[model samples]
Target: MEMVLEFLGNIPWWGWILAVIVLVFLYDILQKKHTILHNFPVVGHFRYLLESIGPELRQYIVANNREELPFNRIERSWIYASAKNENNYEGFGTDRDIYEPNYIFVKNAMMPFKVENKHPNQKDPYFLACAKIMGEGRRRRPYRPASVINVSAMSFGSLSARAVESLNKGCQLSHAYHNTGEGGLSPYHKKGGDVVFHFGTGYFGVRDDDGNFSMEKMKKLVAENPQVRAIEVKLSQGAKPGKGGVLPGSKITAEIAEIRHVPIGKDVLSPPSHSAFKGVDGLVEFVENIAEATGLPVGIKAAIGKLEDWQALVTIMAETGKGPDFISIDGGEGGTGAAPPSFADHVALPWIYGFSAVYQLFKKHNLTERVVFVGSGKLGFPAKAVMAFAMGVDCINVAREAMLSIGCIQAQICHTNHCPSGVATQSKWKQRGINIEDKSIRTSFYFKNFRKELLEMTHAAGYEHPAQFTMDDVDMATGDKNMINTLADVYHYHKVAVPFTGIKDIMNCPHLGGGYEPKKEKKDVKKAIKNEEVRY
Candidate 1:
């Protein structure tokens, strides 16, 4: 050791540097994994470095404030400001193209009224309101959701344990509900907040050893987790509508395997359809049975595709007087942990058209008042939430934005288990970057500020609460539809009246007899809406 020290001390520092560079070059030249490295040796390292940091450079330097895909800089900045409790107000006028096609605007009241402040007795002053869901017969118990903007499903296997813990604690602070994604329940989900346990076709947490649905396991979960406020049966997600949930084998750790009841180092694929139900009638029956067994509110999460299929479900509900307690509609633009490009890109309806179709259909069946509606998919911004409300969605669920609040950089590498921000990966070393305490606080702050902004927009639209916002409060501006029309008009919600006159007179009444049509129903049932640039 002394001899080595003496030799090093005798050698020049540049000599040592040169020696290390030579070693690195030799190693690169010998390695075959990377073609660039093998071809260009040390010089190729620069290319790899540049490629690794390319996303950052494009995000911060090259891309304009509004040019980023998915979520732009302006949107991300708003979330960051809310998370940090920093001022997000802009100094100059709007940079957006307000007159651009598909541009949306709120119909501000001529004399905007002041909305009432939060109740003093409320646990969290940031909590603006709550929505109560009550079911009849077996599902008689009522569950009141405290927040309109709650966390959407992002599974445990997909997100780091630290991220789940932070989100749960944040939900507790903000009085928001945290959804246990279809991956199933974990101890981390019970940190300190309300939960909505989601069940995909896989039947994860409540599945038997045979990977079949287990009533006993479900009862056990409900019995043990009092924090679970509701259950959502996921028929389909907006992203990868028909595809199943995929958890790569490399991500399945011992803990995840146990939680999900799947073999370690084995790829986990959830079935595309539930085994408990075969069709719409079976679906309704399944929901009723689950609600009766759990004695809690049960809902269905589905991406709209077939308009007649939705109509059939509503029609069945009208006939049987039984249906899900709530319906959560996911748009095609919604995010996911992992999905195939074909399913993610081509399947399902966008939130606007989907919500409108379902909403009007429910109104036609006189079942709108009985069921709650939740809108999800790219609704991270206050304006988007308000627009959803105006379109008749009772509440909104946010997935990616919540991830962003806890320091996600939109690396778009979530599926690789190499998330740079530590929000999605399961590796312990990578997960350490997310400080649960700090990120939890940031999450709470973001939720509070978002709700605050939503209320502000609600008041601007002459509504005390977002729930009061109607189709009249929203307008869509585009080149094709130049004039501002109420959402009701755009979605075609024509009114129909039935007179109490004699049967002979009723038969003679043209509107009631056959002319009564709310936005002329399409007669081409055989022809499906073609998947094109503008999908319904």
Candidate 2:
């Protein structure tokens, strides 16, 4: 023992350090989990360390305010400020280029509607509500949404339980509805908020042992969860239109398995199309059946692709007077679930194009008022919401914006289940980062602020409610600096008058402007005559 002690004492500190380095090198080379570590040994660890914090580096130091994709720094900052109830006002006049093509300009009225209550502590005088009552005169229980802006469809499986709970609580606080994504309704969703239970081809939560949609199970689900105000059948999402989803066996925890009604540790496949229904006709019938059975408003959500199917559905509805109560248009740009790059990039129509096409079809059939139009592609912003409302959308749903309110940093690594902010991952360790009470309050603040801004814009546009907005109220730049066109001219469809109760009040209000009148441009006669006409 004496000899051993003397030998250890004689060993230099440098020698010991070298020995530790050698051991680490051996571990790195031997590890099979990381190919980089296995191939490059000790040096490879630096790459991983850099990659782990790359998103933060880019967000803070590398990317500019307006450069980031999905959500720019400016957009994120606004959301964060609103969530914290801080000053969201920008110092500068505008960061956006006014001359840019497709730039939306909200035509302010000559005499804007006077806002009554502008006090900070007081509630907003302009209380925004859905213009149309969902399933009014058609269903057993008609629901009038208190707020026009609601939480979009985001499955509990895709998001952590804490995140879902926070969103539900936030929705309750703001009196906004929560759309439970195709993953099925979890206990987290029943937190006193009104719910729009959504199901995809999987028919989760409402499926039987055979993995088929069971009306009995659905009825029971609705009965037990009284918070479920509406039901939405998701034909396809914007992320991957016509494609299905797969929950890997690795992600299928016991809780998830039970909620999804799938066996534990097994891959679950969601087919591209519903087994319960076939074509457009069948889909209408299915929606009608669910509405009939549940005594609640039933809707359909889809990313627009070909117009043939939409045309047929509208036609059938017009002919039979039986169809979905609401139709949610998911723009191709919408992304909550991870999807294949090909589908996410080039598959479905964008929000503006798709919504206009669908709305026009419904208007053509004189069925615009029959169905509530809900748009869900980045319509969270005040300007975007106004544009959507002008194009005939009754409600707007926001998904990623809601996620941002709950501390999502837009790491864009949601698919890996390594969400740093704990908003998207299922890992308990990651989810522990979310503070339910704090985040819930933030969510409520964010939603209320959004509605406040939207209402402010609505009054500025000489209207009491968003439903009073028409295609003529907004205009888009036509790429040429010399010209601009109304949204009706741009989309090639005239706005059909929808029955709105707010229009009468707006017309009667003395403070409100009569109608949108474009300012006539003073033209140069000499230049015009030199360029073309002698007749003038």
Candidate 3:
């Protein structure tokens, strides 16, 4: 016993350190996966440690405010500040390069429309409702959206239950609708918000035992969830337009399996195309059947590619008057879901091109008034929202912006199921970080602030509502700083006027109509007089 104890005590601290280095060196050299580790051995371990945290380091220390991709630091800061109800205003001059190519410039009016009761403490002072009533033309159960901006499609399975619950509660508070992504309607989505139930090829919530879309199942699901105000059939998403997704068996929990109606411990495959319908004609018929059966507005969402199918669909709708109540055009840049690099980068047409082309087609067919137009793809910002409205979008959906409002740090590791912020991951321990009550309040604040800024910008442009903004109101700068053209000139299509009867129709508030009122606010008499002189 004395010999063994003496031998153990004889090993010094330096010897222990040396043994660890030897072990690490041998392990690194033996590993075949990493070339750096194989060549450099022990020293390569530091390289990996630094590389793993490279994104965080770049985000916090290296990259400037406007240099980051996707959502820049400046953009994220604004969202976070707005969510927290902090002062989001910047003191210095604009940091953006105003003369850059494709720079959007909103022409302000000489006589800005005076907003009355601007700081009302009521629940919803700025009633930014959509111009057209969904399903009104088809004699279905028509609904008027309470807000122009709403939460976009984000599935419960893709996000944590707490995150979904927070978003729904936030939507309820802000009077915005929540679009349930194709993952199906879990209990988290029923938290008092109006819902736009969305289904893709897999038809998770409305599938039969055989995994086919069942009309009876759809009807029952809709009936049970009265909050589901509309149905959206997703043709394709912006992330991967023609690709399908797989929910790996490892990610499928019992609750998820039940909600999605998929077998537990089995990889659920979502086919790229719908099994129930075949061509564009079949698609129209399918949409019509769903709308007719549910007596609710039904819509289609897609990222644009070849226009032949769109042309055919519009032609069918024009001829038959049986089609979707709304068409949501997702921009190629939009991506909340994980996708292959090639597909995400090269597949779909960007939002501006896709939206303009599709809108022009509908205009040509004289079907613009009959159908509502929704646009999504980084349109959550006030300026972007204004631009989208000018381009003839009736409503805008926000996905990642909503996530940011609820404490997402743009980790960009959403596909890994290890989202550090608990916003995107399904891990119970990770999700525990999301406090639903606190995050829900932040979500409501973010939505309200977004609408408030949008409305302010609308009034500044001499318009009562965003729907009244014409393409002539916005200008885009060409490569040369001196060269600029109106959006109408650039896009080669003028917006067809959609009737906006003011917020009174949606909110029953009498004071919500008109652009300017002289009698109510005599304080802006000089401004109003100057505005009158320049009035067209």
Q: TM-score for all predictions?
A: 0.84, 0.87, 0.93
In the range 1-536, model 1's lDDT, one tens digit per residue, is: 99999998999989999999999999998887999888998899899899989998999999999999789999999999999999977778989988776678888898776634544324444455443343533353445565778899889999989999999999888777899998899998988888889989999999998999887787667766667768999989988887788998988999999999999998999888888778899999888887766666899998888888788899999999888888999998886668777777778888888888888898889887678788899887888887787777776889999999999999889999888888988889989999999999999999989988887786677665676777767777745744666677687873222112222232222211011112322121112112211221
Name the runs in model 2 displaced over 4 angstroms. Answer: 1-52, 117-126, 481-483, 503-536
Candidate 3 C-alpha lDDT tens digits along 422-485: 9988789999999999999999889888988998998999987899999999999987645999
In terms of lDDT, model 3 sits at 0.86
Better of 1 and 2 by TM-score: 2
Residue pairs in collision within model 1: none
State candidate 2's TM-score.
Answer: 0.87
lDDT tens per residue, model 2, 1-536: 99999999999999999888899899988778989888988888899899878878998999988889888989999999999999999986888877778889899899988755553224434346677768888986666676788899998878999999999999888778899998899999988788899999999999999999999888778766657778999989999999997666766779988999999888778999999999988998999988887778999999998999999998999999999999999999997888999999999999999999999899999998888899999888999999999999999999999999999998887887888899988889999989999999999899889888988888899877878888989999889655689998899987666566653342232211101111221122123223322321
Top-lDDT candidate index: 3
Give the CA lDDT, 0 to 100, for residue 21 in model 3: 98
